[model samples]
Target: MNKVLKQAIRAILPTWRTTPVDVMHRESGIPPVAQLLEARRIRFSARIKSLDPAHPLRPVLLPRKYASEPLPPLQTAAKKEAAEEFNAWLESVSPLTVIVYSDGSLSEKGAAGYGFTVHQNGRSLRQGAGRLGPAEVFDAEARGALEGLKAALRLPQSASQKIVVCLDNIAAARCLRGQPSDSSQGVFLAFQAPAKRHRQTDIRWIPGHSNIAGNEQADVLAKVGCTHPEPMNAAPTLAFLRRGAKRQCKDVARAWWNETAPDKYRSLNLDFPNCCPPELDLPRPVLHHLLAARNHHGDFADYHERFGHDDAKLTCSCSWRKSPTHLFYCRKVDSRHRMRLAPSPAVAIDRAIGRDFEKFVKLAQSSSFFEKICPCL
Candidate 1:
């Protein structure tokens, strides 16, 4: 096509959604001229050569035609066809609609590249590309969807309208339906603002390549987004790294405190602050160990008097066994279990370590001094 023709097409296509194609074609009246040019080319006539003056007639812009006049209701095969056609034409003119489709590409690192494509309709409106970081395939899919949606919304569209994002990735679709992507913070926020104002505002997922125009375009767009530079952020990848670093720091702290802290540090003489009630006994091993450590230094007869007899045994008034199990398991005395009866040698150490780590976490979270001391984390 000539430059004039290309420019004209761009100008008129933006109105195709609301305008009837028959009306548009009649208004454009370019078919006869196009046919005439085709005839001239077929004949290889001398007149065709002569028509090319220093400047030929400026090309007439043609409005787009909807594939079907009466759109079928949405269901069944016919409705599907109509929906596909309607969406195709709408994409051509709506300008706000961006479709992205994605498939995974695998590598030896147990990694996958999300193959993607972006399109407005049959026309390739724009493209994007990206590479997955250390995330699962589903995570990659969600990231791609989020990226594509962001790209579309950032385009020059009417401000009143929210962009419709179509994707072929089922995992991505599920993720969007379930939870917003933490990585796509900007896009997630962008979508959230309109959600408060409108009930129908949302990104949509269509089946892949089911002859669906938007889905096909999305597939192309996703591929482009995959290869293109990631959307702007101060440290998009760094957020993940920071999160990982935080977890590693916590693990290291816990391990070190367990290995080095004394039994007293683990069983800090407190009454299980910030823990479940003592009545619940909710696996509060550290609290139990702490109680045991404090009580273990006292008289065994006192421990027995507090929690020695089972309720059932007491009710029956029977002589039960006098083993450590009788004091701990049978009597359900946590102090007895923590102080003496636990078979694992590591249990006491673990309790001691946990108590110290808990204190450290609290102090670190609250104290400016602690923050300065461990700036590496």
Candidate 2:
């Protein structure tokens, strides 16, 4: 067995970096690497003592008891036994009544999408999706959890019901389980909406791509929701569970702006939009002035909050706005109106545009509003 292990290690060396001694010990259980090499039992130049499990080189060296146990010497074999032991322990305690899997994703930076599937007795109970915009990854994960619970609520209730929510994301499960940070606003609010219903959920972590059935399905749905660029209904699936079905106080004006405004402002590509007005409508003349300040890099006689003009050559940074040039340079009445308006309106407009843009991006990323915005390039 030792000689066979040496040959296996040499053959495996082309693919892996493990030492022959390490391979032999991992393969042949009885004599161990050191004893086999000391007895001229294996082919290797290094001293037998160097191959000792007690040597400082190996971190995964098994204890004497580990070798004595009726187990294979390979670390993989040991881990399999440990996993079986753990599975036995869990089965003894709870018996795993249900497995729920959930996932969250974002198409753009601000949008969030999530999906979940619930299973028990080898059957699916429910699954769902939530779409919104301008939320972070943490927020998306929370949405997955909250939305997952909502899906589970569609099933029959029982006192012995034990649900295991397998999450593709660690942050989300950790956040919900109180292992790390708190859940995000979308998730927190989603959880609150359905809290009265799904009272028996247990959050759990599972390694992705390990053939977890429900987890893979949930992942596929999450990908679809995240990658799909079309606009959606923008309703959280858990909303029906909320008391009186009262919706969160969303700013409709912000939503409208995001739906209509160009991507340059909403996507944070430039600083000029952030400086736009928020509450009040901006006049046409001042809009041009701010656009000019942003694009042409010009100076003004007085730097109004919106307009930064460089009058020496009369250039500014308004790259998107349509200008006939005479609008700013003309000594006409309209150009005078452009210069005389209160700076407050322009300031308010710029700020509002910025805020609305951010909110739009966030909400659009949700599973509900998956719309793609083609900015005016």
Index of the highest-TM-score prediction: 2
TM-score of 1: 0.31
Candidate 2 residue-wise lDDT, 51-88, digit = tens:
43566564333222221335221123343454454345
* TM agreement with the true structure for every prediction: 0.31, 0.35
Provide the overall lDDT of each model, using Cα atoms, as 2-decimal numbers.
0.41, 0.45
Superposed model 2: Cα runs more than 4 Å off: 1-96, 108-111, 158-160, 179-183, 189-199, 227-377
